[model samples]
Target: LHCGTGKVSYVGGNSKSPALFISLLKRLKATYRRAKTITLIVDNYIIHKSRETERWLKENPKFRVIYQPVYSPRVNHVERLWQALHDTITRNHQCRS
Candidate 1:
């Protein structure tokens, strides 16, 4: 869930945030028309293994979800993006809502 900085918060989540992840996917696919396969790298969360999600994955082989091992946030590029956003916000004192 990548979003431009604003009043709205775009959230990318780990296994702990299933609803947010699913919601982000819905938002992404709503207007997306490309036929290319989607490759996703994520942390291992229990929700990724949910029955419903698994069924969806089976039905959609074009979407690939790769789960990284635990305690490896440093390897996730989203962490760097968040850090950059934090730095930009803190430098301007405009992070708080």
Candidate 2:
């Protein structure tokens, strides 16, 4: 999500993996082609620290990832957005899959 413009860029898959995370980064890079640097505020998910991810970051100098302090969800705005989404859409629904 873009903190300045509130624009969100996302990718969905069956699971979160280093490849998936790199895919998201590639999308962001394509989305902001002229940006000198794209800053991402992320949680300390294992994928974010995976060796593959680290190598990818080294290759992609334009992307920067800043991990939020552990256990501090309130510092991440995306968490709040997700909480609201769950509350409104999935907290108590009759959609039985």
Candidate 3:
């Protein structure tokens, strides 16, 4: 997740899910284990707020996860980056679904 100053980026071989995200959070926790809190502003993705994800959050009191409004892409800076990436790499690409 991207913050005002710091960021935690990961590339995974598997698909995105609550388990992978929770693992990333565990890494963030280890990085700043002593920190009082780590607030993550995330998009309105299903996995982001799944029951498993909520359970993970409950177990780790130091982390707070907030979801952005549905359909409000303007608030998410990464959306712009993703759009650019699509324009650059996937605009005319064709692959198996």
lDDT of each: 0.60, 0.86, 0.77
Please list the Cα RMSD from the true structure of every candidate, rounded to 1 decimal place.
6.0, 2.5, 3.4
Q: Which residue pairs collide in model 1, if any?
A: 15-45
**Model 2 lowest lDDT segment of ten:** 69-78
Off by over 4 Å in 2: 90-97
Ranking by TM-score: 2, 3, 1
lDDT of 3 by residue, 12-86 (tens): 535788888878888888887888998887777887888998898899999977788755667877677668878
Error of 3 at 80 (Å): 2.0
Flag the better candidate by lDDT, 1 or 2: 2
> lDDT per residue, candidate 1, 1-97, as tens digits?
3333323334555434557666655554553437466566666667666776677678867777888874465677676665786787756683334
The Cα RMSD of model 3 versus the native structure comes to 3.4
Against the true structure, whose TM-score is highest? Answer: 2
* TM-score for predicted model 3 compared with the true structure: 0.73
Query: How many residue pairs clash per model?
Result: 1, 0, 0
Clashes of 2: 0
Candidate 2, residues 51-95: lDDT per residue as tens digits? Answer: 999999999999888998655666876888878878998798866
